[model samples]
Target: MDERVDDDITFRRLEILLAFMETGNLARAAERLGTSAVTVHRALHALETGTRCALFRNEGRNLHPTEAAQALAEVAREVLRTMAEGIRATREVAGYSADRIRIGSLYSLTSRTVPAVVTGMKIRKPELQTELVLGSNADLLQKLRDGGIDAALMAVPDAASDVESEPLFVDDIFFAAPVGSRYADLAEVDLAACANERFVSLSEGFVTYGGFLESFRVAGFSPDVVMKTDDIFSLMNLVGGGVGFTLLPGRVRGVMPQQVQLIALQPKYLMRQTIALNFLRSRERDPNLLALLAVCRMARAGLS
Candidate 1:
């Protein structure tokens, strides 16, 4: 892309482009943009002229944006959001608002680990503004790489290059089944015993699911899987509803209902996951990240 062409693109033009794509009619687009229809049309014309593309076609006095228009609008949304965040961060550092930090974590940790970490950070730095983002293991790690989040609290085996990680704590995996299931009567359940049972597990992209499969692999058997969900709660609900048994981390103890029973796996298949806090190595010196690290360390040490 030519720098001159890039320089010619403006937020106003992008806004008009997005508005037009969203509303599809010049009058409606102008209403949303708080500008005259003529002005909106002029902005659209300038955008197309600068980009040297025909962004739309006339369909009975209404402009129908081409496929290119939709694609550019999508890219424009990301660019505008990134710029807005950049400006917000600069303003925050300039003392217009409290210090902001973005922390990402796995959805399963939302019930326990994240609350503990965020509470500690607020108690220590009262003015620190924190955003807690929750997603699957892969999503959180990608956010860390994209600079969307400052740190990620997730399981090990992340294996993302250029990222620095520190172990926060260890949570053992347990076999979850419906209350009063045959396995619940036993203190410990062997993987071989469940070889005939159906399992409900999370889908791929989650480290917990990986560990669950690895445990079965180590036990030399593959249990029948009835369902695979994306949410940990959904997995638990399936188990509680007697859909099938699942494997979950010990941290879910607080949220698991009495209808769900967690049986300790046999020693040979006992899987423990190390939840770690990871950030870009380049962001090692960021004070907010350091503060989050410190809070996590203190919390982990206290639990120990």
Candidate 2:
């Protein structure tokens, strides 16, 4: 009977296995574990030797966990949870329980939505510490996946598998045209009416842009995009200049230039960009995450 239970391989091999299960690829798992594929391979070899069973099998380029590995995963998860709780308890006992909440947001939210939410949260829980990070939707999603942020406020993408999203708000998209434009006086207009008009748009990867494309698809026409800018304010400025009309969030009406007219669409192919509070489903039980979520929900209700 091998009683060498405290070997470093025991913990490290379990960590590698968990990483593999999360990513389903040796290279990605190794990257998450902060080691090379060779090290992960060696760790798996040690694990198989210690257990006297095959843990995984290579299927094409990906590694598939064997039935034994699948069974072990539940145990591994519990072990890791216990280890984490132990560390947390130790830290708490040492009077180091100042928890940190890390949050990420898209640029649009960072301007007003996130700040307002953070302010409201602080007023309610002054002792809670928080860190805010801002980036494009894709960048923020990647950061969340990498565990760099505990939660994020973003426009929910079409496909989000591992993330749990709670819809916070539905931001309506509108057309912003110059005040005196031919279509300015109309209460509503269809996209087909402006098919020949030049359109200013946000650069690729922006949620606004994504919504714009979807709206066009529903309207049965592709927009004639004449210029693309990353900044919503810049796009607004161009629309004010009569360079082109642009699709923007309803919230943007509050910041539009005096010369810009925001037209609500009729038969309203209303493209609602949904703002959601997203967090890794695996971390839903963390106290810090729960607290932040509570704060976010309160803030969202107040705003609504």
Candidate 3:
């Protein structure tokens, strides 16, 4: 037998060989490779032909690797690991290294939600570095899509194909008002009831602001927003100072001063914003992404 080694054998053949060795059956190997059994068999045959050796032989329904296969399997594992490490190193050079997971979230979540989550993530993966960026959902989503951030905790935008979302929590929007205000006396005030009240609200780029607008639209009225700001803290400050009332999440209430009172919306058009962990679907399988996701899942469980 003339043994010839071809560099042109291709990574696909090596991958198929590895899959077959790991799975120990043609059908299962094909499934792992996302191909048909015939395709996997052909690739295996091509690998054997290129190497001038039998990699596997049928033992009843199971395919058992010959000595050559076992030897090649070790080489294949090392090659795959080296390839992965090379790719990771290259990504690091290009600044995509997963040494630090960049996280973006709304200002409201920064007070409690994000901090709690990060504390948990730190406990779980002490070596994993984290960078937390605070911004509105719209701003954070844009950052996430642009690769400025690896993931975000924010309200899900309208259907987007590029991003994957994992729901972390749902926060209810509350009607916040100054204490002893006319509306403050009511246990729950309807959207229509606040139609004439001066409002302090988030600017156009916020998810909560969108919900605020939607709630008013549903109630056959538009909010008379006297002031608009980018930060939830600013909005809360304004409300606390009696500049105007606003619709904010209950979580925001936790950080606000005592003067601001949160009341339930009547006929309760309860606007619940779902906070989700968002990441690019294209990078889902990257090892760094896997680690980040594991940390996030741990954080979510701890917070819950």
Candidate 4:
């Protein structure tokens, strides 16, 4: 037998084989496939010849498929399914490659939402490549304005005429403190309660830093900020090491150490952070941008 899996094994032949396997007769298979019985027979015969194996046996006037035919039918279904998926992906990308959906995000989301969005986008386009850029909300916005990134997932800032942004989810600001401290015992912490507590925070430029300052402003007393660092992990580590309590988004819980406890802010002081997907109006229809937007919505929707 001259076995081969080249172009000789055509999709048309596989379809006929599957139909015959289902109906168990040439005429019936032809009717199911909207083709003539002779055409179906010829396709099956060609398939058997290409595979160099006998896929059917004649018993009286009836043709019964052999085990090989049944096995080939299963393989054909899988191949066709994969082919359909590839065609759909190609259509989504308009057959483009070497293009990346550059995604800029905040440090907080880098631990959770960023990864989920990237994974979701890949699932939608297996060949799609993504670049995850992490920075402060201001830095991301600058990159978006300068065309450094295709899109961004970050806290929504004031609207600009050229940038298109949509709110995806609202994450509540919380008071982050050491796990066993007195602040950790409270179900929710009021800004006034932590007024005298030493505060550790990310330096200026971070969206969370603004949130932290706002919470203090609303309480009518300024926190005695003991440390101000440019990185969130360092700030979190300081908080966890009993350096001070800090204000952070709820998503930060996924990144910081177990010794750090995040408590909700009291209703009066609770700040709602609007997470949004930002893009330039000009690139709204770009296929890669579209796919990334879809994933951002899905990931945020799941969180909501």
Candidate 5:
């Protein structure tokens, strides 16, 4: 390409030229592009001036494309089509799905929060497919950073430069036990009072596990762990089966089994987790993320 053409030519100019070629007049081209006729004429004039070529010839008030313009329009059409394909292919190679969004979340959120958000997202973008990936908070964050997932729904992690988050809601930590357990009858559990109680906890890396640790730390003692599971559902099952007591977030209350009960923790031992949407800061402006974020805001409005 010549330096003059390179300096003057642009995607927008090409699009306007193609529009004019198809419409046969400035007013119709502007209408097709949803722009003013003056703007369309100005863009064409600028394009002609920049290219330093005879792209158009005036016949009364109408302008006709010259031979050079005709040839350039042919190339422009192919250029735009090829560029479109290239953009799509490049995004896929980068693991950025245009029609589907892979979202990472904690297993616990699968019960309600994730379902609600996914449904809302579908309603907003009917053509979009959603894939849910369940994992611990640490795992989810790592997946997001690695581009294995588009976004994550989990407890807000500590501040990091590479990630940005939008907090949806805060969930308080509670003491969970089987229905007939002595602690089940308590109005609010005094964490220290249950220090000697056997517990089944989610293993490390889980957001709930972090809350469990923090609440216990505040209570001034460590929990007696009889088992450590990888998922919150299993830990809840263990507690429901009377295997041991465990700490859980209030969000899990909806999914607690008939055999299990959650008791509020005493104020002194209170712990809360801020659940949020986490994504790479660089992708915050992505169209897919924008749609996901809109639904998240809707979820937050109902949750908060």
Candidate 6:
């Protein structure tokens, strides 16, 4: 027989051979495999034929595995184990069973929501590594759609067919001003009244920037934007140092320096942002995403 014929042995046949070897009895192996003794006997015989080598000898009503069978069984165990590991690794690379999950978010969320969610996820999955990617709301959404990140925490935008969102909380936009500004003493800011005020704002693409434009549009005139920043922290600092007044989300209230004060917009000019977790609709059932979704749900509950 050609020695290469051993390559013809299938994993299913090897499994049967290993089962028989481990249990040391045809009936016991069959019982272990949820099959009949006759089926196990036939599979063992076929395994020997496929390898073109004698692997068993009948003694009375029982069959005993030969030395060759024992050695082959050991190799088979290692092969099956390696195959299982390889499959798992492949799935992880495909993001189906990832060991690490990438999370995208707006820089503003770093203050409270992002940290809380990260801590909760780590506690729930001690082995899972979490990577936080910070960007503007539009940038984070783009990363999510491109599969550059697994999920995003941002202001929920207009719906997209490929993206699914779960709202975590709602944040009202506020007029951010320096503590000593004349508007600081007002009960609520009338944005129209601040039309001539110099403003510092997050640049285009940030959710807050969109809100800023919309709020001013509602106020019937745009404020003079003196500086536009990509970093929410820098924008807040600019406002704190009195570089200019700006429109900001409520989430930024306690995070800015004492020099910065956030006050409500007048009723007519009020705008609210719904902060949500967004991900590819297709990955909604992914295990890593499922864990994140659970953590986010708990966060929402706690906030409420």
Root-mean-square deviation (CA) per prediction:
16.0, 14.7, 7.4, 13.3, 4.1, 5.1
Q: Candidate 5 lDDT, tens digit per residue, 206-236? A: 9888888888898899888999999788888
Report the CA-based lDDT of candidate 1 relative to the real structure.
0.85
Over all chains combined, what TM-score does candidate 4 have?
Answer: 0.66
Query: For model 1, how big is the CA root-mean-square deviation?
Result: 16.0
Q: Between prediction 2 and prediction 4, which has the larger lDDT?
A: 4
Report residue 20 deviation for candidate 1 (angstroms): 56
Worst 10 residues of 2 by lDDT: 91-100
Order of candidate numbers by lDDT, starting with the best: 5, 6, 1, 4, 3, 2
In model 2, the runs with Cα more than 4 Å from the true position are 1-3, 6-98
lDDT of 3 by residue, 84-195 (tens): 8999887765336467778888888887678876776677667779888888887888888887888888888778899988877778888888888887788788787566
Candidate 4 global lDDT: 0.83
Off by over 4 Å in 1: 1-98
- lDDT value, candidate 5, whole model: 0.88
Give the TM-score of each candidate.
Answer: 0.67, 0.67, 0.72, 0.66, 0.76, 0.73
TM-score of 2: 0.67
Model 4 spans > 4 angstroms off: 1-98
Model 5 ranges with Cα > 4 A deviation? 1-80, 95-97
| Model 4 weakest lDDT span, ten residues long | 91-100
Better of 3 and 4 by lDDT: 4
Better of 1 and 5 by lDDT: 5
lDDT of 4 by residue, 4-47 (tens): 57666898888888888888888999999999999998898888
